[model samples]
Target: MGLIRKTLGTALAVAAGGAGYLTATTNLTTPLSADDELWSSRSFKRFNRHRNPSIQDVCWKSIPLSDVRPELRENEEALTMEFCRGAWAGYAYAPQRAIMSITNKGPKTENQLFDEQQLASSKYELGTRFSDHFEVVERTRNSVTLRGGGSPLEPGPREVDGLFVISAKLNRQAGTVDVGLKTVFFNSAEPTGKKPAPFFVELLHRYYARAMVDDGARRLTRKTP
Candidate 1:
């Protein structure tokens, strides 16, 4: 009886720890800045017309890139795109992707989702599509805006409901690059008493957003010599 009780206690402890981790948000994760360009975007403005408390959040993590291969480090565009690719891969191939595949709706492999030719070109221009669901709305030297138009849990016509702005901005002063992901939702059915999303929904979204940037930073570091 004691052994069974101990085992149950341990399991409960593990579950509590995981729940805490998922809900925790650090200083790097925060509400979107008031002056962010997305606010001025036509699509953003249109979707927000109803004054719904659509979620707008950002999370950032920095990784040193000074030791990266000279060719990549010197080419700002290349470095930025590399991080973007890594970040998108993290989102597209995370454990959630595997769970989604159980229903035979998700891509069997990464190759099925990404186009080799487009990835090779690494030219992220306006209207560029990734995985046939996310479309690029803007691309600057350090950041790219991707508008998601499909559901990961279901397959059908693309429908835009939100966007993400991923950035790899070099901080010369710190000899590091900040990889950031910002989420702006166009619509929501989730309840929001005084927040953009319910407490539990915000918690999960924050954790997921941070994980995407963290994965990208880790991938970039692995590429560094």
Candidate 2:
């Protein structure tokens, strides 16, 4: 829990329910890059940025945390987000409950900035991210795929709620990241794994999926502020 701090605590603390609808009653300037699926939802204000790599720093508000538990909130509250300076992840558009993301927000450098290793990948946001660098796999409702690098950080089997989760150890070799997900027991035994990404980044993607929608212009605001 070394990464645990106030900001990160708050990010993970915010959970989500079913797909919440944002009203589109009024005409607004939609981003040209807005994806069709995202444009159709109320949760996402913009669609194209949901998966951008250059976007590192982010700030959002009025997120969907209505159904989250106080225990979860408290658990997340203790973490500081400072540790995430390296690489961070977030949702650019309002993705369906089914789709999520993991971003990169590490120190700015040529290799860090230029590497968009995830472009060719599809499905299983977490696995496809860094699978090329570590032993990572994904189990989606449709398929179970593997995307791993030659190097594997062995994590003994661990269960969270009767499901296997990505337990890649962080703080290993510097600049090295590992992450996984609770990929078992979906509609199918096999989930989708595109690749692997940094460990802390996995946290960012998972939590950001349920994080706040930064674009208020997309949401239906009350007459009063």
Candidate 3:
């Protein structure tokens, strides 16, 4: 009986330790900057009434801007298209659940410009689960602003909208390019009061920030040798 009691106590301690480790690892504790904002449950409640709700957040990444700029200029259309398509598939975020296929509407022009009208009229498929879409509202030499959304095809009113602005600048003194990705999520329903950020939403933001950094780094690396 003494031996059995000791074994059970040991097992319980091990289980508690494992639980603690998992909680620590999954907790959203990423540091924030003056420019960054996280969407908390409270923010959601405040914006619940409007047709579009906004959750503003900012994330930054460093890359070889000099090397990337030339490539972007040379193949802006192709690169932008690839970025948008990959975004729906979860890119580096959720590889196993990435979108299976994507389609670009209208003529294949030298510059692929999908403004608000174009985006509103077109539809995309994400593994038969969701219909994804985006609109390129503005584009320039070093920046692009757009809005994206996804909706389930099944009989439900579930949908999500997002606004994203990506900009790249060369820090000549630092010898690096600073890329900033500002994102705003629109909620369909309003929130009731101030609440902490949802775990899933926080996770999504982190994944997206990391993915953007990775994508920029990959592009710069490819141009190196």
Residue-level lDDT tens digits of model 2 in 61-85? 2212222222222222111111111
Cα lDDT tens digits for candidate 1, 1-225: 999999999999986775465345323445677788878876565445544555678888666666554556656677678777676666434555445445334354343345433443456777665554566767788778876745433332222267788777777888877777888764433333344446677667776776667656665666532
- Name the regions of candidate 1 deviating beyond 4 angstroms: 1-27, 46-51, 67-69, 91-93, 99-125, 128-133, 149-160, 188-197
Task: Point to the candidate with the largest lDDT.
Answer: 1
* Cα distance off (Å), candidate 3, residue 106: 14
Model 3, 1-225: lDDT tens per residue?
Answer: 999999999999986775454334322223334344323323233333354434455555555545554655344343443333333333343442333223433233223323322322222222222223444445555555554544222222224555565555556677666555566666543433322346577556755555654544454435321
TM-score of each: 0.68, 0.19, 0.47
User: Which runs of model 2 end up more than 4 angstroms from their true locations?
Assistant: 1-152, 157-207, 212-225
Against the reference, the lDDT scores of all candidates come to 0.62, 0.25, 0.45
In terms of lDDT, which candidate is stronger, 1 or 2? 1
Candidate 1 clashing pairs? none
Scored against the true structure, residue 97 in model 3 reaches a CA lDDT of: 31
Model 1 TM-score is: 0.68
